[model samples]
Target: MRVIVDHPGWTPASEPRRTVRTENSAWTATAGATLILNRVGEGRDQAPAVDTYSPMDLGGSIPENLRSALEEQGPVQRLRTADLWEALATAIIRQVIRADQARLMYHRFCDAHGAPLPEAGPSAFPRPETVLALDEDDFAGLGMAFKRRPLIAAAGAFIESGTKWAELPADVLVEEVQAVPRIGPWTAGATLADVTGDFSLYPYGDMAVRKWAAHASPDIDWPTDEGTFARWWRSFAATPEQLSALTVLTLALGGPRGQDQPPS
Candidate 1:
């Protein structure tokens, strides 16, 4: 009955629960008959209900073939990150790296500079001001030399207009986030998807998505090229909402599972 979340910023907490720390709050979720969310702090109001979309959102409008493929994979839900900076930072760190490497680097970066929340195993991502204050040596010390400029650039941009940026719709948010140097379309799209739980904003051409889609439906002749694959994937959906469900369900087919051990 234990659940392990493989996403960055979340750490295994107790049995059957996962916990995360944001700048102003600590949150935990336990899976049972119903997924229960608890915020661990006084003075702060309860955690707000998070809106999520799933394959069911597409209803009967989903293509029969895609629906059959997804049904074999069971249910999947995309959970939005509680912190925008954390989502953006995770996307930035993930650029051009393997998912395992990105996960390690994210933990290292957070452990080094982020504020600690003992109750939550993982540290909260450092704030924009904190990231802006770090120098080349500081980043190099954590083996994040290549990420320094982009992280600093993003931090500066976030400081300037992040509040306004958070209010934007997913499509617009991707474009606005790309304004930061070294943050390309893929990174921006990933950030938008993570922060909004809107898979329509995901970079459909991403290798993970491409790989998982092919694996999830072997009978379909998926394109090998990224651009072509993205188009082919999109062609299966009749609407933006259906497209999102298709992408999310495919990812869930190969998504990470929790282990009995704690996060490394």
Candidate 2:
């Protein structure tokens, strides 16, 4: 099975799906699915394709007011990283930087130290242990700041704690991660959403979300409170995180198709 992931910054080896992309390029991991099989010690035996979520899956769950805005956009699909460490590390790298800059650095980091996926052409992002072992001088010219060292330390701590870190509940994960020197709500929330498929976590400090959510749903009254937002989502049996994605897609592509997710 061929896997192609287009989400920028997610490394290849850990990609849950077979596909992966860099800052500006997409690559097919021809043997990615096979690798998943190998990891689980399963022989190739005609496994079924994974069922993915689509906008149509939302159905009546969409709020009435924002439906039109979201309906006009291009294809949007929910994407997840291959693992918790990948999600957490990627979030840390993206903090307070322009996306293009961050993605370019991420590409460089992966290219230099990522593990070889011999069956596929591209390499996977280095594991937390590998990242922790890299010398500070090696990070030179990669556009990383001094703070990246501590970020790696935090990731190492999380990774070394074994299943304990992975098992952290959503709220607890947020609290624990935010305790890291430079990690914040936006980083932690984004990690939980990507790693755990927790769509209820809206990364609160994002400026784009603030602007888009306000513009797309004016009826709710902007800046009312978290409770108001929570209440709004409950009415549609949806989540602020989900609505945030919808709002972003609507703002970005004008609208999404009936069958595609918006801003996932």
Candidate 3:
């Protein structure tokens, strides 16, 4: 059996296992077994919470075509990022780029500025302080000059009220994160969804979502504009939970790994 970890910054480690590190913990996951989490250095113990949701949860709410596609893709788990900074940073990096491009940039940014976890073979995202301390040359060198302002602004905002933001509900969190200068609706929505496991907070009109939805059900006429498509997407689900499930399942159907294999 093979298991793949879909979380950003995670990397494969030997057969059937993957590993990642955060500020407080180092984590290892083996196929068909519980996640093994250990303290990174030492400062209280922390572990990531894995939230699993099934496509079946949406039931009759989804269209026959979408439902069929999801069932074929199978169930997916939402592993919330242990660090809010990491989530925010990821969203900032992903803005206005293809998934493959964003992924390469993310890995590059981490390797350049983040602390290395040698044993695990992946680096942890740089802290807010580290981001603030960086000069323009540093960002430009990493090919992240475009993201410099947003990253710095987010770091400052996170330093001031990350704890409070973390406590806010998914909807509120999305709204709150937008206060930073360059952190717009789409970025905030993506960040909130990543940390909270509430895909209802995702920017439903995102190109990826729209693209995959159209790909999944070629017969359905999905809207082209962001606003109209967002409303059209909402009309399918009677409840927020259903909306989350529908959007997530649709994304999973044509995720980065491709259309056939769902994220585990």
Q: Best candidate, TM-score-wise?
A: 3
Model 1 scores worst on lDDT over the 10 consecutive residues at 255-264
Candidate 3 residue-wise lDDT, 1-264, digit = tens = 112244445443342333444555766544343344444555554566665656666746566787788787766664567678888888888777666666678778878988776465556678899999999999999888998998999899999998898788777777888888888888888787777777888888877678888887789888888889899888888887878877777776664232221111
Q: Which stretches of candidate 3 lie over 4 Å from their true place?
A: 1-7, 11-23, 28-46, 256-264
Worst 10 residues of 3 by lDDT: 255-264
lDDT of 2: 0.53
CA error at residue 68 for candidate 2, angstroms: 0.4
Name model 1 segments beyond 4 Å from true: 1-6, 12-23, 30-36, 43-53, 59-66, 118-120, 257-264
Candidate ranking (lDDT, best to worst): 3, 1, 2
Summarize candidate 1's per-residue lDDT along 1-264 as a digit string, tens digits: 112243554443333354444446777765443356777765374463344445565656434565776776555543457678877888888888766677678878878998776465556678889999999999999999999999999999988988898788777888888878898888887787776666788887777677766665567777888789888777777787777767777665564331111111
Per-model RMSD to reference: 4.5, 7.5, 4.1
| Per-residue lDDT value at 106 in model 1 | 83
How many residue pairs in model 3 have overlapping backbones? 0
Using TM-score as the measure, what is the rank order of every candidate, best first?
A: 3, 1, 2
> Which of 1 and 2 is the better model by lDDT?
1
